[model samples]
Target: MGPRFQNDDRVRLYREMYEQHGPIAPVVLPGDVPCWLVLGYRELHRITSDSALFSRDSGLWNQWPNIPADWPLLPMVGKQPSILYTVGERHHRRSALVSDALAAVDPFELRDRSERFADQLIDRLCGRGSADLIADYAKELPALVLAQLYGFSDQAGAELVPGINALVDGGPDALRGRDRVQAAMSGLLTSRREAPAAGVASRMLHHDYSSDFSFQEILEDMMVNFVAGHQPTADWIGNSLRLMLTDDRFAASLSGGRHSVAEAMNEVLWEDTPSQNIAGRWATRDTQLAGRHIAAGDLLMLSFAAANADPQVRPDRTSFTGGNSAFLSFGHGDHRCPYPAQDIAEGIARTGIEVLLDRLPDVELAVSAHALVWRSSPFLRGLASLPVRFTPTPTSAAGVYR
Candidate 1:
């Protein structure tokens, strides 16, 4: 078995393994499960898309002791079981419901709401000179957007953020937070069902399908969607801001009005994807991947960071100046993220960043880059504290984002 990975050691292990061996590497978990970490773009894509061979069902997780049996996150309804864990027809049905609702909603409507939220957040931080990017901007934007989608009040949205954060960033106390989040989410779904709103929650409550979905099942799906949609997005926004503020070339391109901020946002998504590792999948049968033999029941973990950074796939990948590549920050194929509103959120974020750059081009990090603490979740990557020093941009006698 490999050395037990402490919370701090996973990133180092990932970096060292990626730097030494190309993308895919064999790893033995502390639990003695032999797993292949698929890192290369091609391999990651293959494993994630090949649903027949790799199963998302939590059956494999039974091998590991860390996961709880009554884990609120697991899917317990439909033909195939497990919330985010099921596969095949059941997964397809659940995904269709989400996609349909998202499709019915106009992206522009979301953009308008996000822009307003961004403007307010920027106004609050405008004269402060420095603020924690995670707290003030990154965390706030996504929560508000989610609230709008769910038709929840701003206060409810704000309350969900810390619980969501705690659930994803597992520690000794994560279960406590997870329990609270689960209960709150269940309550929210119950309320939505009792008093329907004109939002995704209402849509889900009324969604008609052959499969029967219970309140708990619906809540689990919503919770997954909530976390998946916001957490990584928030991380990407925080990381992108940090990168642009420090790198003059990138910052200049953003502020110069030369390259579109939309393009820059894409570059940020491609360059610094928020999610580093995806959950493990079990191989149903023997398989050959990257010239390695994988026995049935073996686990595979996809590394979005490694795939995005692969030189073979993204030549000149290190140069974040610009790129046309679509990053797998949202995953690929059957497992693709359901929230299509990201483009809307990104648009709003880009506009907000542009406003910041235009108003305060000389803004620099309040502390050295090294002093910024990176978030420790293996699944998510972001700065916990991104302090910056900028001459407060004069509240444009005109309004913000005008």
Candidate 2:
């Protein structure tokens, strides 16, 4: 599929694939890379949870040799030393280190700081009576917040966010973005090692980490956190606001005092998960997934958006408010986001969204929801921009969005 069709209207294409191929469908991506996509919620859970049958190791993938070098699939399916790319004990060790490091962060601190960032961004353009929520608000809040959590110097966030954004975009600029991420991580790691600052890198170095990680491995781990935290979280916030701005029932509920920001966040998770499709995983052995024939070392993808909207699994079409926990948006099994840590992430999002809604209660979409642009990535789902208008709110001496 071309970039425009794959990104803007993929939800419809996914439904078509499901109708023809059922739970598991075989399709080729932009570079003619063939892989199976799991559309059924139950089937996706089975493949993702049962890691023994579906390995996350891209090295086991036999398709790489056949694929061309400049296929634009390397960033997603390529080998890496991070927990995201590793399997088995290595996965466990890296996960432990990350979990411990995230645990060290105070959630309250995160919420407070995130509000400050949101307020600061909003302050920049609040008085102008217009805002591109995606650019002014949604983009940098998560970027800077994640930078802080990842232990990078807060000053570097402006440079760091866009580079990582390129990495996750999964296009021609992806490899370039990957290089920036590595260099940025190296700079931060070397700085942290010498000065010994506070964050994931600091804790990872001093804590009783489960795995003996090399410096490069540590850099990869930092990339994983920043990548995981940045776009997806930003999209979650943007999509949640889009929902609140576009859906009448949703907007009424939230504005009419019937719904909570947490519910809105979950609603986005349930239906419009940030990473609509995950382009990793390979068959460990010859097997039948959901009664479909599959060979060993076959590349696979999980359609989290499709799976969450499965009619058989989730029949309730009434509301997207209270999201189900079973959604594969954040994934499951060994590689899924851990508890409380996941809660912390959601809290940051909720706080960020709440800050905007409360500050700019009269804000309305400047364009039709259907007119918004989505980023062209094989895996991620993000709005290109969310233009919004709000009545100018006066800023006080305390420097709030008013």
| Best model per TM-score | 2
- Worst lDDT 10-window in candidate 2: 252-261
lDDT of prediction 1: 0.68
lDDT of 2 by residue, 258-344 (tens): 356667778788867887888667998999876788999998887888898776776664655464566778888887876646766
Q: Per-residue alpha-carbon lDDT of model 1 for 170-199, expressed as tens digits?
A: 766677868877777777777877887787
Instruction: Work out the TM-score per prediction.
Output: 0.83, 0.91
lDDT (0-100) at residue 213 of candidate 2? 80
Residue 126 Cα positional deviation in candidate 1, in Å, after optimal superposition = 2.5
